[model samples]
Target: MRGVTELLRPVWRTLPWPSLGAGSAAGLLLAGMARLYPENFDPWLALNTLRTAALAFALGLAFLLDDPARHTTATVPVPRFVRQSLRLALVAPIAALWWTATVLLIPAELRPPVGATTLEAGAACALALAGSAAWIRRSQEPEPGVSVAAGLLTVAVLAALLLPDDWELLVAVGDPGWDAAHGRWGVLLGAAVGGWLISTREPART
Candidate 1:
């Protein structure tokens, strides 16, 4: 027990707790704001707003692996996967809870399709983390959050612009493309996880 705690201490210490806290607060604030006009609510509008919040929080979570002591930690006895998993394990619960709370904060009638919206969130968060991992694997920077977040946002914007109308990824519930959009989301989620796992492999020791 003590051994596990000791191993996780640095992971916890290195976590970007402030960013996580701020992101959660911002997300919930956006979620709560959805209640401001329930009578005037549109499901598509609510989804877009809530999605903004989720993306913001995911961007914050992307910073989980931004160890300021990356070089020093790499020299520690702990395996990279152990340390990375510890970082992820530490943040996972909070992320789940925050998502749940965000969903609840919006009035039920105004909420988007829960399953589909959650799928989009899952894909987005996975992409953010995977992008961070890829950046860490390729670059020597101790912190990759800024670049990761920027790139994530850029791709999101570009996709919104470039994707065909028939294949819209952010389709309204019950729209013809809704189910298809989620299928794409599933593919994205799988790809992101695969990339993260492959990139996160402990780099060949020097």
Candidate 2:
């Protein structure tokens, strides 16, 4: 436990705070826009706005694994997963608070169901992290954030444009497909988390 505690400060310094802060701010702004014209807000608008906000934040999270000192740290006594986990542990509370504030930005009477929207956000954030983890696993890039962020954005755009209705993951509330869509989201979240864990494994010494 003391070892873990000792890692906290250095790990905190290594976080991609700029991107994370930008993403959090962008998400909050987008969600808060719904409040600008409270009378114009409706369930559908609320849902899509929140979704966009979530995506914005997830884009920032895509940079979570970025480290200019990645190669240098690879030689450290501590394991990569422990370092990574420390980074996450530090950010988790901030993320929770950001999400809470974002949700509260929408008027309660017109807000979409929190549980479902939160699932979508969670899935998106997991996908971003998984992408970064996979990149680290497959390549030697010291900072993969740019490519990962671009890829994340591309995936989101393609998913929005290409995913067919039957397989849709972003259905509106009250739609016949809402429940099924969330089920798929649950699967996606699970897969992303699994992929992250698997990718965190250091390559076997050649």
Candidate 3:
């Protein structure tokens, strides 16, 4: 308990607030577009707007692990896993609230299936965190956020443009392929979380 409390202040200080704030603002703005013409609400536009908002926030999450003091803190008594977990712990609730707000910004009648859309958002966030963790594991860079964000953007674009029809992940709510698409989202969420856990482990000491 004491140990955790001691680590809290430093961990809080290290968070990437700028990126997170920008991402959240961008997402909210996009989601708010759904309310622009309350009488003309379109379900399809609401769904895509939410999707874009999720991606925007996920791009910000790509910076979650960034710490300019990484090298300095490497020798701390607390394990890297604990520190990283703490960071996630601190941010998770805020992210959840942000998502909820984003969803509620649209008219209920125009909103997509909450469960499916939430799954997609969760998967996107997991992928971003996984990429950040992987980059940290493989490099000595103290701040890898920019590179990770760029990589995430590139992957998103490629996935949208190049993925074949049978493996579609961004299908419409009522499409016959919707169920299968979310199944794929489940698989992706699992894989991304597994990768993040593996990458978060402390590197073996020589």
Q: Model 3, 65-152: lDDT tens per residue?
A: 9999899988878877788889999999999999999999988899999999999999999999988888999999878889988998
Q: Per-prediction TM-score, please?
A: 0.94, 0.97, 0.97
Q: Rank the candidates by lDDT, best first.
A: 3, 2, 1
At residue 131, candidate 3 shows an lDDT of 88
lDDT of each residue in 1-206, candidate 1, tens digit only: 46457877667777999988888899999988878767766787788888988888987877878988899878777666667778889899999999999999888888888888899998999998899998998889989988898899898888888989866787778888788889999999999999989888887868
- Estimate, for each residue in 1-206, the C-alpha lDDT of model 2 and write its tens digit: 67677778877898999999999999999988888888888889899999999999999999999999998888877787887877777888999999999999999987899999999999999999889989998999978888988998998899989999989887878999999999999999999999999988877888
Candidate 3 at 72: error in angstroms?
0.7
What TM-score, to 2 decimals, does candidate 2 have? Answer: 0.97
Model 3 scores a C-alpha lDDT of 0.91
**CA displacement after TM-score superposition, residue 103 of candidate 2 (Å):** 0.4
Task: Report each candidate's C-alpha RMSD, comma-separated, in the order given.
Answer: 1.6, 1.0, 1.1
RMSD of 2: 1.0
Candidate 1 runs further than 4 Å off:
1-4
**What Cα-based lDDT does every candidate model obtain?**
0.86, 0.90, 0.91
Q: Which pairs of residues have clashing backbones in candidate 3?
A: none
